[model samples]
Target: MRFTTIGAAIVDIVVARVRPVLGAKQDVDHIGLYAGGGAVNAALNMAALGGEVSIHACVGRDLEGGLIRDLLQRHHVRADIPDHTLPTGKSVVMVDESGAARAYAQRGASAWVGEQGFQGLDQADVVYVTGLSLKSQAWLEQALSSMETPTFRLVVTPGARQLSHPQALEGLWKRADLLCVNASEAARLCDESVPDADAVSVEAAESLARKLVRRPGQHVLVTLGAAGAVFFDGAQECFHAARPVTAVSTIGAGDAFASTFVHAWALGDSAQNALARATDSAAGIVQVIPANRAGLLRKL
Candidate 1:
């Protein structure tokens, strides 16, 4: 199947195991520059998994933007995104010894991507979009209003930042066939009374899923880091448990899972089977520090 990926591309600077000291320069360890962004990662994952994938990821006309283009080419994912005046988007990710990470995101060129970025996507059987790209009103509107084959699927994986834009959320999510997000993102979309306020339990996560479906029609998939994921098949829900593994880095785990799930599902896998495939793909990447397209597909 042919897949079209639309989203953000970034140069990720990851600093491992360090405490941030606001006022002084500190010793930094395990610093590496990597090509990243929700859409970029997911597109690469799909390409590696043997899907014919093409992407239109927005970036700036700077060194970092070139890096994203080279990275996608290395992974064999096609891209034709144009560069705007802003610098390429980036993230400074700081990981503590315990495998927890905090990221300072700069949505530079990423924000500049509008409806035009997705011009050729309507021809694809599966159009996968990430949380980062949905921030643009034009891009989100384009996806919602585009004319495509009846089977064309709009799979959205929105980040927590999207919650701030309620009008955008209603418009995008209401039309999206699939909604993918982490526990924290789900927590933000739900009401304060939802159980497991921390999104630590299956019941609580399903509570949030139930709410998403009341909007006539939609499917929700909530990924709970170590807890695996919860899949809402319309109103019917199921939780796929995660296997034990020492995570090297949780970054991009959700993107990996979302890509694999869409690829498998488009190929006609059952919902349960698709979730299992996604779980396995994510588990492999999380246990390794850096995952390129080849490494990720080889794991699968």
Candidate 2:
């Protein structure tokens, strides 16, 4: 299972506490720091699951960048760190007692990845692209065009900014073999508000999956929080149920799911088996408290 993931790498500074949903200021019960970034997290997860994973992304010249690289290497992930002077990406993740989180993301060196950074894509069996590193249409086109391998599978996970540009996203969607998104992103692409306004609803997930699967050369996967996920592969549809768990933080669950799914799928697992594996992995992530969360990229 040779997999390549392209996106930003960030240090996640997480603070967890028991506080009301709305407040001016609250006391933090604990704080934890972890290597984080959409693509990096996925790459780490894939490697942890015994896949041969390589990361194609940029990091800063700062200590945070060093930390991110060290962490990936510790997880046995091959990394292609480009030279950049910008600060490494960073995120502040706050988790309430209810296991819900809000994140403030700052893209630093991640935005500097360009055509020169995408030179090694042809060596991968599967390629993953996230909206985090794709800032412009030119960058997306250049990255995709650089792939010379006819059998390379392309997986696209649109970031928040990419959701605002429907035409550009649709263009990229056509080139992707797999498209994974949350309910909000799916609704944003369709130019309509999702029914029931809940990401975990079957209606919203299935609707979004259907819309994306209709695109040429794309299989759609919609992740529904604790409800698990749904995959639409043209003529067939597959669903997996989430495992019951007491969650401590849900911040990294999506990344965990996407990476696990890709790893399983790349290994030729059926859609049902892949989804089940992904759900179990995500459930393990959500149960870990921030301060006690260690070896996040290690095999379970």
Candidate 3:
């Protein structure tokens, strides 16, 4: 299965340590930098899992962006990065001892990849659009409309902020083949408050999925953190169990899960198998120190 992921490709400076100070005396124990972002991570995972994947994004003409491009190329992911003058997008991720993270993001050159960047998407079998990339409504709409192939599947993950403007994305959502989101994003789409770590929220998630499935050609998949994931395919409901693992960081787990699931599904795996593989892949990722290792699943 060949896929193209359209979104930001960021240089992530991840600090995986806990310190006492909040503002001034904050001390980090370990700092690791890698090429990362939702789409980048997903595309890398898909490629690592033996799927043909390409990344379509923008990067700055700088050392950091060059390194990121080289890393993606090393993983055999087709890097379709446009040259830009702005610094490459980057994230400062601080993960506490408990694996929770606080991130500060700078969307530099990534935000500049406008409609022209979507010029050659007709060759892809599937296009996964991250919410971060959809921040530019005009560019996203233009890209979606530019698809020349009718068989190209569209998968949309309406990240956190994009859900606030449902009307802006409703048309695209109606055209999407799959819609993936977390419980909070699902709740926001459904105009409900999702409870933290609660079992009852699955119903809310399912409710949101139902509404999304009502849209033509759309299915919904909601990731429920440690509890696992739920999929609504318009006819039935499927739930997958989360793997039990000691997480070092949960930074890119969701992106890994989404890509793995999509990859498995594209390979003709059963829904249960796809979900299981995705959960296992993501669980393995969180336990690893680097958090974005492509071969992390080999350990499982």
Candidate 4:
């Protein structure tokens, strides 16, 4: 599949063996810099799965931007990054001994990508919009309107930013061919019946997905890490159970699932089969550290 992704491209600085405690001096285990961001990760995953992928995002003319470009080229994914005044986006990630990570993000140049990114949207088989890119709400609305004929598939995956803006997200949700989100994101987007955002039941996920499906043919997916993922169309509901695996890190597990699901479904797999494929792909992702690395998820 030929895929075009619109979203953030960030450089992640990871420091392992750091405690969340305020002021405690401890020896660090390791430190590394890697390519990250929702769109960047998704693009890398798509390329790893043998899909022809291209990314539209902005980055500054700096060392970080050079690194991002290098990573994309190494993976055979085409990148369309315009020069910006602000430095490239970055995240300071602190990983505790237990493998849980806390990140502080600076959007920087990622917030703007200009109108050039939308020029050849109809030419690609799939155009996946990640939540971080939704920061350009006005531009996104305009782009969606211009593609009214729906010549290509549209898949949306919401992040914290998109979920915070109900009206904008609702507008995009109505037009999306496939809307994918993790269980926690689904809980936040759903009604008050879902009190806990971290732990959402399959029934609640399905209900939440059902409510979000505005059109007859739209598909909504709620992914439950480790447990499984729930798929809901206007008329059908399907759940795929996850396989057990020892996880090294789960930072980009959802991205893996979303990319794989879209890739599989777009290639004519049944919804249930696609969900199973996605589940297996996510299982592979969690087993690797620095989850955003390209080539981590191969065809299973």
Query: Which is the better candidate, 2 or 4, if ranked by TM-score?
Result: 4
Q: lDDT per residue, candidate 2, 142-163, as tens digits?
A: 6676655557888988887677
Q: Which should have the higher lDDT, number 1 or number 4? A: 4
Residue 219, model 2, lDDT: 87
Deviation in Å, model 2, residue 97 alpha carbon: 0.6
For model 1 the TM-score comes to 0.89
lDDT of 4 by residue, 186-207 (tens): 7677645444333677887788
lDDT of 1 at 204: 77
How much does each candidate deviate from the true structure in C-alpha RMSD? Answer: 3.8, 3.4, 3.5, 3.6
Residue 103 error, candidate 4, Å = 1.3
User: What C-alpha lDDT values do all the predictions have?
Assistant: 0.75, 0.76, 0.78, 0.80
Measured on C-alpha atoms, candidate 2 has an lDDT of 0.76
Per-residue lDDT of model 1, residues 100-205, tens digit only: 6778999888766654645666668887877654447556576557654446777877765576665567777776788887676777677454333234688878
Best model per lDDT: 4
lDDT of 3 by residue, 51-129 (tens): 7888878889998788888888889999878878899998888888888778899989877655354655777788888
The global Cα lDDT (0 to 1) of model 3 is 0.78
Among residues 3 or more apart in sequence or in different chains, the pairs in candidate 1 whose N, CA or C atoms overlap within 3 Å are none
Ranking by lDDT: 4, 3, 2, 1
> Positional deviation of 232 in candidate 1, in angstroms?
1.0
